[model samples]
Target: METKNNKVFLETIHRKLGFCSTTYVDPVGLSGGLALWWKIEVDIDIETSSKNIVHTIISDKSNSSVWAASFIYGSPNREGRDQVWDDLMGIGRTEILPWLCIGNFNEILSSEDKMGGNNPNPARFTSFHGMLSVCGLFDLGFKGPKFTWRNNRRDGDLIMERIDMAFANAKWRELHNQAMVFVDAAIGSDHNPLILNTSFPMQKVGKPFRFESFWTTKESCKSIIEEAWAVEYEGTKMVKVCKKLRGCKEKLKKKLELGFNPDYLVTEKIIKGKLEDLWQKDAMFWHQRSRIKWLQMGDKNSRFFHLSTIQRRQRNQIVKLKDDSDLWKTEANDIAVVYFVGNLVTWRTLAIIGIIPCMVQVVGVFFIPELVKIGKEKDLEATLQRLRGKDADVSQEAAEIRDYFEIVQQLPKARFLDMFQRKYAHSLTVALMVKSSFYKFVTFEVPKTLSFLNCHEHNLNQNKDLTAILVFSGIQLYVATAVGCRVRVTDSHANTLLPLDIKGSAGSLITFCNWASAWVVSYGYIFILDWNPAGTFFILAGICASTVVFVAKLVPETKGRTLEEIQASLTLFT
Candidate 1:
């Protein structure tokens, strides 16, 4: 895609792409270029051209629908990027057709559009937001990878940004309301390909079973349920209940297929009338548009009213939800999907896949040798020698392992009150402060942040955004926990009394905090914060801030200090 001359590859690409007509804005020194290829069925007329954009009016010969599409290669520099927005604003004013603007804008609207590296300049956000506002363009949210552009660095300095995007105005959304933007995997380039589908295809799925209120109106329905429940089943109470409900559903389905008896025809008429009245009311609710007022007074407008009701119902319904792979799953059969071996698989497949690691571990464990500390000194040396290698020296390592094990055995057992002693007070305080704050943030605040993400699902990308948030947050949690583990190990190694017991007590604190956090997050949201996402975050921030201050004031540097020294320091201070 990066080239200065159209002759270099445009003709070949056009032919291979099966596009009848092709046009391009030549690159300015191999850095910026734009190419547009269209099939014969699409009638495209070039309306304007610039170094960064190629504006065209595209008409579908099949439907005779016309729209404007601007292919952009936004300037990478800040000053020129500002000019690109200005040009787009001018085009939005002049162009009357439903407009679509898609390409690499080389800028992002907000911090969420990027990941890693230093935060972007706020002025860039201002320019982008201003352009979108002025042009009345709404971002057509995408699926697939959250970030489209990567720095491609193998080092830790890598950065990713969602610069490539699709945007359409209100008019364009009306014309193709089902339009979707898909970010395809990047091949041989750092930038991912953006696929703008004007109409995303969806599969038709049967509606889920729901018990009708009308069914409850009949005495026969009550008899059918009772009869189904009366069938004896051999299982646990929960299983019996499930079987009964399923039986009831099947019986109701069969009864539904049989036409109403002659005796209930009057009841059917009344139910039908009530349903019609509800539909009529729904129609009245939606018929508030000025042009539909003339037909509002009589049954003459029933057809229009019914169609309006159907449209409103369809618009409000959630027929499908997008899966992790960007596929739409209409059926509710799977309550959850899990990623197995780098691919998203169904719950059934995940159950099967979940056993592989366990089986491998079970088989692999038989081939492994026992611990060196479990035997006498002679046996320990022999075991260590075999584990290391037949030829490797094991005398020094065996002696060290024996001495460490002996020391561990000689240590006194830790008691519940021993942790409260004056010498151990500082250690306990540090553990409580760190563990409480860390676990609270991890178990409680993180879910609250996820709740914030749930609120924005409609406006932003849904499942994929959630996945990205989880991925980064999980990585952060894992790395921080790893560091804490290293510190805890060091602290235990330096302790004189009941090192294992102290470690266990610290672990117990972690477990208790973790258990308490779920209740705190659940009831805390209801009673304390009233489910306010921002308020929950503000409270978490205050907790974290206070913890930071507490750590700075009370926590001592235990680095390179032995247990006796640490105890002496605490005793001197007290």
Candidate 2:
């Protein structure tokens, strides 16, 4: 036996295997099982076994089940069928046990099994009954006279055959008193199907009640009775007419459980209408509660206080409905309770009483120290000005230093210098020149000489005592001057006086090895020489050599310059 869906297929397989003797087990919304039916043959050995029993088991990809005896069997050949009968006889002989072989044997047992009476083939029936006798098996009584198999054709007189059968051992015959097959109506099939119903006297068992079934059922049977009923009461003072009728609730619940069976229960129309009414009522109640909660939780002003009270009353009503247990309770009750307790009224009251402010204070502890630090730093400008005193200019230099310190505090120390240079290029430039005047002088003069060697003269000066240095690189001549000392290089062609001045007492003019092209100076000395086309270094070397020669050739000592004589000499030089 098989079915279209695998679940049904497995179920039918189980039933045919004798695991299920009655209606097959199934969940809701599933139809009956068997699709195609066939019979098979099997053998058992009662002689060699402890108990020679034929096991019928149905197995699909998902699940399997076994039965004590099956009605479905298979054989490889005619010899296999004979061999199976021999094995059953062997079991009966050895173990003194009875055997049963049953199933859908694909071949017809007899030509008489076919419907519309073609002719009965006596030989086949004789052979099959002989095999059963040899195995000590007897046929269980069936209610049908015609065979179970027919050619699946509608127009012609259909060919039928008795393919499915059940045979049991002598022991089963004694144990089971009544077993008969019932041929059901032709349900879109030429084969009039057969079912063997055996009375096993098994008790029925009920499964656990699922809450979903009850809930869905209650929703369907809500309106069988009238909406209002007048009840008369005998009271001491006055007769009161009670109108809230909860009558017929139990009846409605039972009807819901029966489901929408049109034949036995309420009409589908009434069930559907009641279900709709229940659904709408439940949805509207929840929706109203939700809106109320939203308003109470979201509102900041007291304008909705009265509305909030009305919402609270409505919420209480909903809660009462939910708590009744009969009205179909849900898990949303806990959530509704939380919303009611945490309403806007309560939250606002807490805020007004400074409870929220206290919480804010607790939260503020972590950030307050850092904020204070920032405030102090922001006020540092005024503090720095006061620290610098009234006459202080609050120099751009000092401000920049403070800015640098601030940056260094914020950034890494390695990046502090780079950031300072980028922000204050001019200040950094002046500072660099002051720190390395000698390096700057050399750099400036060498580039100037290469660019304007014949066009201009160059002059440079350095003061060791004042730490001042200056250079003048120009056309015609190059001159470098220092504290209380000066060197002058005159244009050789002009033969003009190259002014050389030494200040203070013990100062004197010294000239040595003057050349036609260039000149150099050292101490209170001067040297003029020809330009070396080879390189500037050679020219500088020659100048230094000439300066050495001047110091040796002409030496005059002076302590410092006299102001009057220095001014007079400057006037004479001009």
Candidate 3:
């Protein structure tokens, strides 16, 4: 209200808020002032003005409905309030239309409105109450903060008051019966901004379901989940999974609703312990001083006077955010209690950061060699039992793990040098499969598969869909041909050149390399294909070289030889 009527400031405001027609009361000696602005869409005329008033006549241009709105700023001091009350009485006499009296009255009607202050004077409260009664103005109900004006203090001596309020006469109330005054989130201001909304009754949104970690400690949690999952549902496996999850969600929500209470966060229990510690320290200090105890300015329990001091300092300052949720949520009072409880026991945090890793992960790493060696028919069950917690039943599981581990111990452990042996060509094929799988998934398949699935799911088909389909079919045919050739490699020659396992492994190796080549050709030139033309020749040359080498070296002329003779001939080269 004390803002200077500067040219730059006015122009900036106009640029921001647009060129709305406005009338304002300027402050006297930088003390106090007011401004009323409206769009051309709504007709507003200044009816009158005074030191603390911006009375206006507002009309709906479409409906031609009119109302008298009195924007009041009650005198800051109690002495001048009497004159403001008198002015309000005079204004009431002139009110011919439905009237709305809004803004800060700098007064409250009850002791409940003030916090951390001495009981308000009964006479002052009565005077304000009486004025509202005579003026036919009743307080319009509000949502959000019960207290609007905070004293800008977060320390123990912080004060809050509900002095600012909206009051409408009976005719005005009937005109917009659902009208509400919401105390919007405060911006660390002494007073919260008030919003008069007549559109609809604001709803206090219920909080969504949140699974708390503490629920697992309750015995009922297991029973609730089991019961919910036991309910039958008809669907595919995915649909059943979703339905069961929804059932569990509802059950957990119901259980929490019945058990949860806000009182658990009270500071009384912990603050009392803090006071006890403080008492011990204070007694020690006084005893050691040995004299002048009475001369001390403070009492024995001075530090413990108000547990309210435990709350966070300056933590109440919250700024407005674009999201609507922030508009109704004010800073909570229990923030300090949470901090006090957290700092009171720092070991919980330390245990999570330090000791937890050793118990679960670090110990497992140390035992890995022994774990791998202990493979048996039942050893997998033993590992699972260890994971489930010591209290779980594990006698049967232990036996299962032991049997499973023993069975696993009988299997061959393939080694690197084994792959080089002619009898174990399968290992080399396995290596190629692993190498190509990575490249194919990352480069060739992922982007195309994702684009295809997305297009179908979202009905996002473009004209290029047929090209994508043709490319898919071509890839399938190429893969089939490569696979069939691997099957016929043994048939092409009368030689038992490789064991069946080795032959299959070689085939897998060939198929993997084929995909790997496609991945490189598809993705490698994608970037340079835009800038240079030679990438095409480089790819074509690679294909030609691969075909020539295959025909010239890998293909053998073993047309009519017996299996044993062909094997002997290939063996000579080996």
Q: lDDT for every model? A: 0.65, 0.39, 0.57
- Taking the tens digit of each residue's C-alpha lDDT, what string does model 2 give over 419-510? 23333333222222222223322333443434333222221112322321222232123333221122222122111111111110001111
| lDDT by residue for model 3 (1-574), tens | 3233543455566555554677767667756677666766689889888768888889977557788888888888987888888888888887878889998888987888888857777787787887787888878756668888877777777888897788878777666655667787776557787888654433334656766544554578889999999998998999998999999999888877786443542552466665664455454444333333453433554322221121111122231222211112222334343445456654234333443433444334334224545544355446656777768886675564355435545655533244468544333433343333333322343334433343443332233456567546645654554444344433333114443323433433344454545444444433333343344334433543453454345444456766556445443234
Worst 10 residues of 2 by lDDT: 502-511
Enumerate residue pairs that collide in model 1.
none
User: Which should have the higher lDDT, number 1 or number 3?
Assistant: 1
lDDT of 1 by residue, 72-127 (tens): 88887989998999999999888899999999899987898888889887876798
**Count of clashing pairs, candidate 1:** 0
Which stretches of model 1 miss by more than 4 angstroms?
Answer: 1-5, 203-574
RMSD to true structure for each model, in Å: 21.7, 40.8, 22.9
Cα-based lDDT at residue 296, candidate 3: 44
Predicted structure 2: lDDT: 0.39
Where is model 3 poorest over a 10-residue stretch in terms of lDDT? 306-315
Rank candidates, lDDT, best first: 1, 3, 2
